[model samples]
Target: MSPPKTYLITGTTSGMGLALVKHLLSQSQNVIATGRDIVSRFPREIVAAHEENLRLLELDITADVDTLQEIAREAWGLFPGGVDVLFNNAGMSAVKACEEASEEYIQQIYTVNLFGPMRLTTAFLPLLRQKTTTTTASSTVIAFTSSSAAWTPLPFMAHYASSKAALSAYLESLAKEVNPPPFRISVVGFECGGCVTNLGQPRQHKQQQQPQSGGSGGLLAKQQEEKTVYGDGLGKLVGMFTRDAMAYMPGDADKMARAMVGVIERVGKQGGGKVPVRLVLGSDAWESVKQKVEETQQVLEEWKEVSWGTDREGVRGGAEGDYLRAVSIL
Candidate 1:
């Protein structure tokens, strides 16, 4: 059997984060679960049973960069060695039309979903690298719970989709800079499907409730909106996420968490094999991404002439050539 791995996961108060903590513990892996109030908030049963393997830390991903670095230092001291995996799983979603999304709302979404994770990743890299450099037999991985919304747009989710898309793109760029030997940091993003978690809860819940469940973060929706052109359409959108309605969604949080764990373990075993750039979970996520890819291909084929016409004729040159050559692509 593969040996237990140390995982430091963020946003562990509930939803995908909590489920992942439960799943990893069941596998006898060492887990450093973090959230806003993880010590008192983590389930007592699991904590008591796995006291030797589990450690709880209070981490608010949206904190300032310096605070995040301090927390990373504290987390580094919890376990005996380097963290085997760092799951940047904390995220929040906003549900509003482009016109109705307040600047504050938009900023909150970006802070929690994109900027926060980026800062945390920066804070934790030194520790992850330390582990990799010292243990030639081990590999360190960083994973994100990115969403299928990144590729498949959904109504009332512009901010959410855009933020996730930006995060995924950033990870692609980061992988290129960090995946070298001596510090073999593997970066992956999972484009997960919708699941029955607090993530779909309306804005009221976000303001009124405490974090305690398995969800990316509670869904965001204003309780009241001034009359607007969207009218009935907006009403229908809000109605679709009522607690009863969300319960009917096909994806299961536990199942999604289990799938994520399985994929991470499988790839970790591959050693130097090419790490997956993005992985989609759930049947719905699969279909949505597949359709998006097909549509993108069609658009590219039809726009091929316009695309090529914009570029200068003959071989690439100037700064572009210099960049390509510097990167060894030419």
Candidate 2:
């Protein structure tokens, strides 16, 4: 009999990662869950019960390359056989405009959203390759937790959106490069439209700094800009933010887990064939994706003539200009 397929998931302490981990384990699949605060912040009972299958590895995806490599070595040592699926589920979000956002803020977001996942995936590729080569596996899948925001541009989230967009492009290109038998890349952009997750929490650094209102012109200028730009939308965004502030789901976590498991099993059965690279988890997410696609298509169709540059051809090299050019040359 074949052995149970193994999975290595990052950011397993909360949100979709936690949900995915729980669901995979319930199916009796072996999962190695990594998180920044695996030992301290996580619930004791949860980790204690799943100790056999769940190896708590301390990993901050945003850490330096050397540190990440060390963590990867430790993880590989613990799971020598390698994982069938590597879910890059850890990420972060920023809520400020691109211009207003600090360089540090943008860097932090990219560090977690793009570089961290890329590093982790790169580290695990050898092990994944080994599994495919030795077992004649159909394909090994690497899934990423991308956002709906990746597709649709959103106000005050240029940095977050840009990072996901870059990651998406990178994954798409990487999949093409690694096209070989039993070795495949599957990127799942988990468009969690308004699901409950702790992604809305205020930035830790911002809270620590706590902007003082004392006669600082810069502070007032920022406040004024925020008021002008955010105004009514701020309230709505905040409400949605509060809703997804934790991993808890209004819908059953198990059901969501089942959906993910089904997708993974389907991919496995198909022998590593490409599945829908984008999976909209909830109804809201589906609606949003659909609307955005439709809107984009409409805009493209509307501007097709101008975008194609056919309309400007006559204006650029018409009879009058052709006549002038011919005379001038003579």
lDDT of 2 by residue, 1-330 (tens): 656677878777666677788888777777888776566655677777887777777877777777876776677666546667777877766467555677788887788789988888787777666666677665367877776666765666688778877887766656555544555544454544444455533335422211110011111112223444555554564455455533222334446557766776777464655466667666655676799889999998998767767655556533587666533311
lDDT of each: 0.76, 0.63
Candidate 2, pairs of clashing residues: 197-244, 197-245, 197-246, 198-245, 198-246
Identify the candidate with maximal lDDT.
1
Candidate 2 regions exceeding 4 Å error are: 202-236, 239-254, 270-274, 310-330
| Global lDDT of model 1 | 0.76
Candidate 2 has its poorest 10 consecutive residues by lDDT at 211-220
Error of 1 at 202 (Å): 6.8
For candidate 2, the per-residue lDDT at 60 reads 73
**Candidate 1 worst ten-residue window by lDDT:** 205-214
Q: Could you tally the backbone clashes for each prediction?
A: 6, 5
List per-candidate RMSD values in Å. Answer: 3.9, 10.3
RMSD of 1: 3.9
